[model samples]
Target: MRFSEEVCERLDNYVYRLIDPRNGETFYVGKGRNNRVFDHAAGVLDVADDDNQTLGSKLDRIRAIKSAGLEVLHIIHRHEIPDAAVFEVEAALIDAYPGLTNLQGGHASSDRGPMNHLELIDKYSLPQFPSNPEHRLVLININKLEDRFDRRAIYNLVRYCWRISKSRAEKAEYVLAVVRGVVVGAFKPENWMSATRENFPDIPYANGSELHRIGFTGIEAPGDIWNLYVGLRGKRVSDPRLKHSQNPVRFWNC
Candidate 1:
């Protein structure tokens, strides 16, 4: 199902989607050159389940479609895009499709992902995070949080489920939940533990992924501590180094 050399050359860089023919739902979004659009269906059997849980899930979906005697559908959303602008096109499509099985978020997604009108205002108006902070802290981007204003939701999303150094995580005194660039929530970790069902029974998504990740149980920061860092209006990290990139976790002054 690969493209011919001439077609591949003409297509250049493109953004594509993989669809489940059974349900007419898009299951994956990706960007690549050559015959990359057809590669997922062709190489579905070779992907190891244990190596990457997210990718494993995608392969599983492809296998299910095949078992039903249906071929997976590939759609090129955009083609012949210049290399410089391909990332932005891919990222915008990723944001549009929330249920995509893409292994990682789009490039530079954390700092510039989807935001509402009020969120946009806060992002531009908030005070910048301290460039040289004296306190030890772990800045976590909770971009996946569904309920941003819910206190418990923010606490749960910020504290639990991360692939961070246990020793370095212990050295940090506080964890701040950053959405886009703003610090929306703050907490103090009491204990750090493996991200397993035993440690995080409340999080169903934690099952079988403990080998490479860790989480924490913690209390909300004291009023003064929260005010200093999060403030009443919230603090924003404008420094390029401090902004959330591909990795959601950032350790500061530790």
Candidate 2:
């Protein structure tokens, strides 16, 4: 059901959740203006709008509920949110609900999303990254990193399979693996290579056709260099420009 014009005006930018009537689970979390919340169940999205696999899943779920002769439950978790603050609200909700059908994390969710007690302590205690780094640096968010303790896993996650410009990617000397705005590891790229099965025989490719992505093979940054950016204590990124927002990649001095 669509919101009335007056209700829409009062709501302004708001965060909402779509619940599965069959199980009362929130499947989607989103933020928008007007009757944007109702659009999903109204069948506004199609295969053409499948920006990611998750959107397609969301559509399928909505269809299933409708076919079962049930209506999807919509909840306005928070309303009249300021335009600037809505992203954080939406992201917080998305993090609170783990299995949401959102295509991407909330804006700046990688940088300032959920954290455990130890992570919270580390986030505040670590040294801040250089505000003006002299080295041509590429800040790659390893937010999706599954293995936090493995050095090899951190390196592999930071170095492989990214959709980026080859020429621009090669210009950077160092890549910083960031997790929740903290520089977890630093590396110096020795080579930039296409993300293909031939180039990376170790990685399992979904198909034979080479993908249009590039990754790097690198060694850990030298101790002196590492200490400057990331030490045993780790480095926290405080600069707004350095924060990993929607894009998993950001460049500095390049």
TM-scores, one per candidate:
0.91, 0.81
Task: Report the C-alpha lDDT of model 1 over 63-145, residue by residue, as the tens digit.
Answer: 88989989989899999999999989999898888878776677788788888998899889988778777889999988577
> Which pairs clash (backbone N, Cα, C closer than 3 Å) in model 2?
none
| Candidate number achieving the greatest TM-score relative to the actual structure | 1
- Ten residues in sequence with the least summed lDDT for candidate 1: 42-51
lDDT agreement with native, every candidate: 0.84, 0.83
RMSD of 1: 2.6
lDDT of 2 by residue, 1-254 (tens): 57899998998888899999999999999877888778875547644434645477788889999999998889899998997898889999999998788867787788778888988898998888899999999998875666565668888888887878889988998998989988888899999988877787776642455477788888989989888988886899999989888888999988
Q: What are the runs in model 1 whose C-alpha is more than 4 Å off? A: 44-54, 144-147, 204-208
lDDT of 2 at 204: 61
Q: Which stretches of candidate 2 lie over 4 Å from their true place?
A: 20-25, 43-73, 144-149, 196-198, 204-212
